[model samples]
Target: MEVVIGLLAVLVLFFAAGYFIRKNIYREVDRLEARKIEIMNRSLADEMARVKELKMTGQAEELFEKWRQEWDEIITSQLPEVEELLFDAEDHADKYRFKKSKEVLKHIERMLDAAEQNIEQIIEEIYELVTSEERNSSEIEEVREKFKKAKKTLLAHSHTFGNAHAKLETALYEVYEALKLFESETESGNYLAAREILTKQTAVLEQLCAQIEVIPALLSDCQTVIPNQLSEIKDGYEEMASQGYFLGHIQIQSETERISGSLSLFQEKISLLETEGIHESLQEIHESIETMYDLLEKEVHAHHYVLAETLKTESALQELHAEKLISKEETDAVKLSYHLSEEETSRLRHIDKQISSLQKRYTHIQDKMANEKIAYSLLKDELIELEKQMSDVKAEHAEYREMLHALRKEELTAREQLSEARTLLSEAARLVSKSNIPGLPAVYTELLSDAKRSVSQVSEKLNELPLDMVAVNVLLEDAVSASAKVREQTEDMIEQVYYVEKIIQYGNRFRSRDENLSRELSEAEKLFRHYEYESSLKKAATAIETVEPGSFEKIGSLVEEDLEELKNK
Candidate 1:
């Protein structure tokens, strides 16, 4: 019981020590956390001051607000956990203090990172705003005016709105900037800068002028379709006038004025169309106007009147086709008569007969040539097969000869070994007999006796050798004679094969000549049938030259002479 009381007292002291230690650790952690909060607040305030100084607005302001809210959330949610960790670490007297300090340093680093990001965002926003303000102050008014004018004009003309407005706005902005820069330069007394600005302003004005000039061209293209509905006779004069399609040099100004006059008239006619009720004719007019408008748009884009004028002229030409210059039946009759002229018909009949004859001859020659080719090919194949068979036979004979030679060499070697063995045995027996040693090994003595016996047995075996050696000699002689005979047969067979090959080669050459000659003869006959006497004679001569039998003979003789010369060498 005394020991138990003593243990309880020790536990109470331990509990008191733990309580004091935890309290001190908590106080330290709280202090560190307060310091961390102070640093974070100061960092955030610095960033906010920078943003305010930069005067961030629009999307930038929204982003900054979001960043601030995020910062608040992180501090609120994560700070408690950090404080608890610090408190827990303070109780441990290990490396926990260094570790907790490092954690706090990490939080400091994150805060710094957030501050840097905020500052960078503010700087970008400030830069953008400055640039936008500079641009707005200089060019916004002129650009707005141009955009408004373009929009109104496009709407009035029933033209495309978006693209024209965009173009106009862009051009006007450029002009506005140029003029504003000029004014600014003048106020600053910088003549060179003013001159540069003026040059750029001139270019912008020219571009705008060019764009405006296209408008009337666009209207002109729209007016061209008005002439399509008129009769060909009525439209033709106007079309030619518009296109300067007259025979001679006319004043371009006068032509232009005349075309403009016609266009005015056509416009007046089209204006009448608007007042007409919505009948089929009105629908047609609407479609035509739309088409003309599209053409005009294209013409404006291309900056050319040729395409629009060409379209108008083509429409006028289509209208002129209403008058039948020639009846369909008369045209058909004329075409038939043209095709069937009497002289042409006779010539055609003659050509047909000649062609039929030539075709028959060609087919006959082709068939004959084909047969000759087949026969030659067959002979060539036979020659190849025969050569292959001869090669196989020669290879087999060579293998057999090699085997016989090896067997003969083996037999000779065996005879030599037997003779040497006998000589060695004789020497061994003499040596044993002359030895003076009395107590010699019995094994040595028996060895001497065995050597002598072996010599005697070998001699007896040699004496009793079979007559196969004589038979071998006879067989060898017979084999040599047979090989000679085979050689002669092979030579004869080779000569026969070569002769057959030569025949096939000659036949091929002959068939080739025959085919060429037949073609020439057919050509000559065709020319003769056509009454082309000179050409017919030339073709006949060519045929004769191509197939000359003397040529083949000469070639054959030359080949034979070369073969003989090779043999002699």
Candidate 2:
């Protein structure tokens, strides 16, 4: 019983010590939790003060909001959790405090990192908004400049920026409506309709930007700066659109909603801007528009001058080409004429001279025929007396022929001589027939035929008549006289035939001349119509000179003078 009392007393003492140790550990945990809460509250207060300061100083509101939200998350949501962890660590101080502290510190670090990220996001957003706003304003100025340059007068109703702005606002409204429709379509699970609406919105926005470009103040407002800025915006928008950022994707939709809200706020602010300053702003826009107009007008005038110069040069070149063609035509005509053989040309000229001589002879003969007064009775008496003398001579020749026949056996040599004389007459007649006589009054062929007939008749008459040597000699003399008469007639016929041939050849020559002159004249006229006046005149002169030298000199001189005048003009 004494051992049991001793063991029981020892157990009681151990229980008391354990109870105090548990109580002390709970108290220490509670204290640490309170201290952690105090630290968290202090950090929250500091963060809140920073946000308030930023708001009061008109710092970026987005930045201030982001910082405030971070402070709330730390103080309201994470601070209590951190306090619980600290209390748990105190209860296990020998083993848990070090590891638990590390965990708590890690949580705190994460919160701080989140806060920094929020601040950074806010700053980036502010920077982007400010840069975009500046670029948009510059584009507006460029549009104003383009408007001024495109029209003649800023005061003109068609040239006014007010009209352009109205059109731009209408387009913007259309885009807004399209975007709203796209949202509605996406919400209703109509992806195709949503895509179509988005496409339409994009097109409308593009049109708005294009129209803004026409307004000089918006497109090139600052001649040196704004175009580049507008280019960047256009490029950025294109890039974003290409990446499907403007469609109703989750992230893009959220961003677009935020931008739309911001745009609404901006519109409200613009509406509240003083109405009294609007007239001055419009006046400035008008001035920019006028400057743009002047530049465009100058460009137009310069273009007109350049076009006129080009036309003048073309006209001159055409004239020169026409002149060259005319010159070529003239050369061809001359070459054609040169192709005529010299022998043929000379023959034609000789024929012409012969015809002139024959014409003179014919005129002489005609004049003689007209002037002569002849007595036909006296010519008949002379013919009768000559016939009686011829009859007596014939009787004497017949007696001589009979005497020669009686002495034929001894007079063979005399008969042969007589035959030889007869043969000489026949040869003379043939020579006369072959002779080329000019200016004969009868046809050569008819005269030769008549002479042959006379010879045949005389040969028959001689055969019938008997004659001695003396009578035969007399007959031969008469035959010689008759042959001379036939020869004279043949000569006259040859002259007449020659005259006819000469006249025909002369006529042919003149016809050729007329044809050549006519052809040359036709060619000259063609050249003139083609505006080759100088070359045409040269050909005309050459043609006239060929027919009648110095005849076309006056016309050629006039044409040359006119050409000089044209040059001066």
Candidate 3:
């Protein structure tokens, strides 16, 4: 009984699956039918009616027929084929051949797609034709209005257009011819051809209008503006030439003539309506004219500069010459007393030669100015160079003059230093002699003699002819150092002698009681007599400090005070 129930259940499931498969297949069939109906109901007829409004000849008529034939084929043949496929698909599903039903359904879908594509292509072709016709109609009217306006402008101001007038009129006629061609094509029911013709004519009209617009300005510049500028340049050139300006190198006349010839050729080009690069040519010509003007103006400015600077440069040159003469005089006078180096004398002569050459060049420049041969610009450059040279010469002269002046000042300074050194030496000798310290040691005597000899050498250098101050200063420096040393040693020796005597006298009391102290004082007295005051003082101070430490410090300060007093005396 359980096995019977399971078998019954299996039958139920099979029936149910078959029922679902049939339902799905029928649904697909219904969808295919709907798609077929959609293809049939397409407004291909309505879209074709739009094309009827256009001229139905040439490509338009042929394409319309083609679209109609294609739509008819889809409706009659392709859609029926899809319907048959859909019926086959339903029959396969009923027989429980689902795989076959699916295959038939796929075939039906492919046919519907092909029919739909054909319908879309036909509608698109019709739309393109209709849109082209409409656009061609509206564009032709706009271009025609613009063409007439351009013609009117060309006619009214034909003179301003100069040579471009006849050429522009011919171009307008060509645009009109194209318009006629468009009309001819339109009348023959070649709407697309007419559209192409109208499009080309519209472009031609636009270019013609642009040419007409810019031609007048280009002509004005070529004919009037640049020519006037060239005339001004010519007039200025002639005026400057008459006024004795050296303007031959500028070649203003030749350049202006060349530009004029170019302008004539460009005017011819404008007449032929070949104005592509003529505007740029005119602009270049204008710039060339301006450059010529600048050249002429430069010459005038240079002439003024030469005239004004001639006087100033002459004055400056004269002043420089006078300074050179003064330098020569001062150099001569100073060299008589103080020796000047050969390099110094040679530099002075060189400066004189430079000034003389400058004078000669200035004379030549003046002659050129009088003859009016060289350009003033060249003369101005020469003058600027001359002024620079003059400034250099002045600086050289001033430096040499200062050198000459320094010679006398240096002589006086050397003499003053010599006098100070002599006084210091005399004072040192006087101090030593008045000290009454038996006598100086051999080294002190030798240094004092050396100091005197140095002073004598400095004086001898000052007395020589063409006095070499360099040697004199060297001798003077030696004298100053030697004299200062003698003075310092003299003061120190005298103070030590006085302090040694005082310390010995102060130690006499201890000497009678201490045999060692008495014996050391005796040695110090013998050293003092031998003029060995430094050693004598050391021996006495050491003996005294053994009995009394730090006793010499107070004695040293007292010795300093006594030395200052002796020097003041």
Candidate 4:
């Protein structure tokens, strides 16, 4: 049995190894095959044939053919080796020889890598050879013609071209230098190196030409357009400053000097047309002028903003000052009514002093701004601070007013509740006087006294000057609460008396019918007469239930019937 199990285990491992190889190895082989297919589809042969038609130097074409042959040789020899190895790997996997199969797959992978590298290298060589200067000198000439066209366009607007002349002339010379280098290098059989130079020079010349072509418009914007805008910016700034707008002490002299210098410097650059990097200089100057224009616009906008806001802030401050608030009498009244703390008093004084300080500062700022002693920017923060402080003072005053209003409303409401409580207390006293029942709970009498005392306290508070309203409000609540308790107790006592009378009469119905009932009914009558209604009801009702289970319910029906008959009468 042990041997059988061991053999079965070995068989399982063998199949497992076969499964591992089949799954892993076949997938790897498929990937390698896909890579091979990609290489074949690269069309290296077709590309070589395409390059053959291009008019390249004989030596360059020979070099391309050499690499192409090398690429073909690697594919022709190594590809078959990789395919054979793949076949071997598949066979090894089929036979459950995973280790051998992995080795075969590794070999195929290496050969395929080499084959791919060879094709890529040949493709690079073919591209480089075709793009060689000897083969594409016409492209450089096309760039030269483009530069000349750009130059002619600029010269047509000669007045505007002054700023960009140096750049355009330098670029044309660079084109000449590149052409000479290309011809010299091509004659000396250095086509690739010459072509590289041509490509660089061609790109530079084209970029410079593009820069030169737009000089007419840029020159107009910089020379005519921006200077005019600068004047407007200067005028706008002065206009706002004249209108009492605080403008920060911004120096325009340096900026105006800089603009003049830049325009003059660029004009010199355009005169030195033979100078190198003139294209760069023109672009720099154009950008600088454009920057100056943008800055001028920002300054103009900033000045106007400050002007408008300063005027509004002045109006708001004047209005706030004129508004009736923050009076000593009003603040004193709040302090007296609420009995505010010492800290609150000190804070209020500090706020008043702060407002006074702010007023002085505000006047100083306005005077200085009018006299050109400060810029608009200098007073902006001060204005905001003054506005905020005034607003805070107003908020404090408003809050106090609201509190006073609410307290007054509370006083009225509390007085109304006190009146209602007095009425309830009177009604309870009258009911108790009329009922005249004995043996009541002393707690009810105490509550009645409490209600009367609470009313007295409330009335005293009301009678006082200024009313100590908070205390009065609390006393009124106490009075109302005590009155409600006394009323409930009084009403309950009266109802109990009425119930005791009803239940005693109900027990008499069985007085003659049962001797035991007679004795219990008599005992219950004594308890009822003592004002022990709850106890009396329990006693009489228990004895009565021995005769009739729902006798107490019947008694309730009789009391309701008696009350209804009395009402009808």
Number of the top-ranking candidate, with lDDT as the measure: 3
Prediction 3 global C-alpha lDDT: 0.86
Worst 10 residues of 3 by lDDT: 119-128
Order candidates by TM-score, high to low: 3, 4, 1, 2
lDDT-best of 3 and 4: 3
Residues 217-304, candidate 4: write the lDDT tens digits. Answer: 5566547876786676578667766775544545555666776676666556545443355456656645755664464455455556
Please give the lDDT score for candidate 1: 0.46
RMSD of each: 37.8, 43.1, 7.8, 11.3
Question: Each prediction's TM-score against the native?
Answer: 0.22, 0.19, 0.72, 0.64
**Local accuracy of candidate 2 as per-residue lDDT tens digits, 213-309:** 4454422232323334334434544564454332212232343344334334433333332123433444453454444334333434433443344
lDDT of each: 0.46, 0.46, 0.86, 0.69
Error of 1 at 486 (Å): 48
Q: Which candidate model has the greater TM-score, 1 or 4? A: 4
